[model samples]
Target: MKSENNYERIVQNSKKFQHSQKNEMQKRITDLLQQLTNGIHERNQIMAVSLLGAIAGHNTFLFGPPGTAKSLISRRLAYAFENPQYFEYLMNRFSTPEEVFGPVSIKALKEDRYLRKIEGYLPTADFAFLDEIWKSSPAILNNLLTIINEHIFKNGDERFNVPLKALIAASNEIPPENQGLEALYDRFIIRLLVPPIEQEENFNRLLDSKPSSDKPEISEDLKISYQELAKWREQLHKVKLSTDTLLIIKYIREELAAQFDKLSVYVSDRRWQRAAVLLKASAFCNGRKETNHSDVILLKYCLWTTPENRETVEEIVMHVIKSCGFDTDIDLAELDREKESLDKEINKELYYSQDIYDTVEMGEKKYFPVLATFKDEYYANRDKKYQLFISFNKFHSQDTFNPIDEQGNTIDNIECQFDGQGSCSLKLRGNSYHNQYTPLTFKPKIIFHKGDKKLDVNKRLIYSLSQAVSDIRKQLIDILKQVEKKYEEYQQYLQSPFATQVDIDIAVSGILDQIDKLNLRIKDCERLGSLCR
Candidate 1:
């Protein structure tokens, strides 16, 4: 009797050990998931439910199109729980709810059990998959929604709830259009768009993956019993929320509202409540009770469900990340370019005013001829070569002639001809033909060399002086233009090289850094894709 008792004790001990091993494995899985993603509220939703399913002994929806590895996530979730009850469906137009919910357990119906026999499928199964979920009709959609949300199936007056964990719905497109879209779309608490494997290099890696064999049915093995999940469901609900994470989610919703104006967003009281569950679960999965940033990306993953929203869903998520906080890289160059345009406009309007033409033309007409007379001593003291002169003195000597109006009446004080008010200027600008006589050079040469000792004398200069005075005016204006050109060159030298460089260089450097940082962030993402591939 003692020996028999020892064998029974050993058997009982062995069973306890197996149960303990399962619990330990589950705890480890929960811990591993917590570290894998950022704890953004959105991500926390995905993580929470994933763990909730493990605890609750249910499955989750791994949504999105081909190559995004939507099904892979489902498989991983099942693997994580060490629960073999995870099932996946790549749905189509022909798929019926019964196909996923299981045939009314036809064989059992014969046994007089009116129950849709719930032998397998979603109602009785631990986890289930439904791909292309939107393709189904309102009847099917409504049935599934009721089951997913309530975790209960109705057979006539009888209601049966199962240990359904999570429903990962996948789709290549958005929820169908029409009035019913809202009703069905609202069921997916967490929507995620799985994009194609990015980068051509990752293509080969995906191709190499032997598509997982028909996901071993979710009913094969379920570790956490339904009773155990219910025990922790309240605790999961009690998960703490940090103030910062809440603010971020609110901000994301606002931002999405702006970008996704076409599709209306009406997050219910339930969504907010669930979001907390997700945030907490995410922390739990990663072995953390505290939320953090890495889980944020998972939240982005959830916003996609319909094919239409996939692009915008990811876009909204990335924008949050890039813009969050003070760690942003600014593109100074683009800013400077925009700013510099304003200055250019000001310069064009100010100094380069259209009114300058009027000013110049009006100034030309305002010119008054001047006249002057000076002693021979005064003339000799001046640069003889400037036989060229400003002739301001011409004003003093000129006879002022007054001009008349059209009626030839004297316009006193107005410088009209009848009033004898116009002024003629002559400052003896090196007298040209003041008297009809021999060239001035001939007289100068003869006076200087009374004896015939002539070296080459610039006789042509005398001829030049003898020429008409109008020709001299033209030559003087030409010389004035050359002086203006030189002045402009000097101004350019003062303004360029260093003065302009310092300010622009700083701004340009800032812009370059902005572009550089964005590029680096993208590269890191690409690298992540490589690792995933």
Candidate 2:
């Protein structure tokens, strides 16, 4: 966020020199953070936005490990606001409220009313940071509570209200034993988990950025005005919330609730509220009246607060949030069932058809006892004309042919033709080459033809498939709309049980089954139709 192109910083410097409205504000910060880590579990860039909004007022808590960019990135980001008023405190047992709020003003003591005079410190300045906030005792946290909320430092019994535009606090961990940690932690709406730099370059940057004594300065009026901060707040309220979006949010909450019992984790309401704030903050930055789909680019902080909860939040967004209004369990189940059935059908065909031609060759054969003989229409011709007639493959050839004695002497005259009679010819090699055929037989076309309906059915099926695909796309769109609208709501569950992930394994299995069965059926239909033709 600390780039040379920071127009916000330029405007602030301009205000110091009182320049004309150049409209030369550069792009907002967080470009790299967004580009490199766009939606890694949906934690919004709160520090960046809050830092921008709160030149008049902003506070944050970056919690995680020691090497996480807690103080490093936050301090750098704070510099863009008001030439950077950096007030850092490594909180410890000895840390006093005055160390953060600033010592009581010696000059104000002369006045009748007691007020802490700030020559130069946190009390008079704007941007501040507190490192290892929870390492300090409850007394310190208690002292900070009033200062953080009221923007005033209390001395003895008197309080001095100061202009605190922003504060970036940090903790090594979200400790369970810390008695007052939760309340103190809640003050930081922009709660981010900073991790050790994964990229070697960022780590190098951190090591190279050693503490420097150089100071940057500008006139007092260059500081951000309360009016502008108020405008941001006002502008946030005007953002719209669509009904479809609300439905998506509700669905996400329901999903979270359903899985809470299983995961043994809960997403608190406070986190949801904080997510809403972040959503608005992002909307404010984009110059949008309200958040749209594209704004989710970095606003995931509203959803997740810890590294562990990031997966859960991500599932809600990438799967559930992305797949809104769609539950394909039935389609999947049916497809699976069809696949099983088709497998069995194919397996049943593995056995080849037993020879039935020999059994039927006997005169007037009744065919094999096991094989069912059904009446099938066969081609037969009356003089120069073809007519369909029921023929039996089960005739008893023994009765139709002349009886033969035990000596194997045949009495019937049989005709054998070669080459459909090469126009009607026969061989007479047996019986001393004297026997031959005389009558000629004709063959008829055996095509089973009817009105062609395949084209119509194919067209209908294509239309239906297209319609189904359209329905699927519409459902997906509706879901995305809901997610876009309830982005804050979706984020709320990211770290909570309500933000549970869809069973990827199950979903993938089901989808694969559907595709496989659909392909199989399509293949079978085409094959059968071809064979029949």
Q: What Cα-based lDDT does every candidate model obtain?
A: 0.46, 0.46
Best by TM-score: 2
For all predicted structures, in order, the TM-scores are 0.47, 0.50
Scanning candidate 2 in windows of ten residues, the lowest lDDT window is: 382-391
Q: lDDT by residue for model 2 over 453-509, one digit each (tens)? A: 232234554454444444433443444444335432322222111111223222222
lDDT of 2 at 176: 57
- Residue 453 alpha-carbon offset, candidate 1, angstroms: 72
lDDT of 2 at 181: 68
Candidate 1: lDDT over CA atoms?
0.46
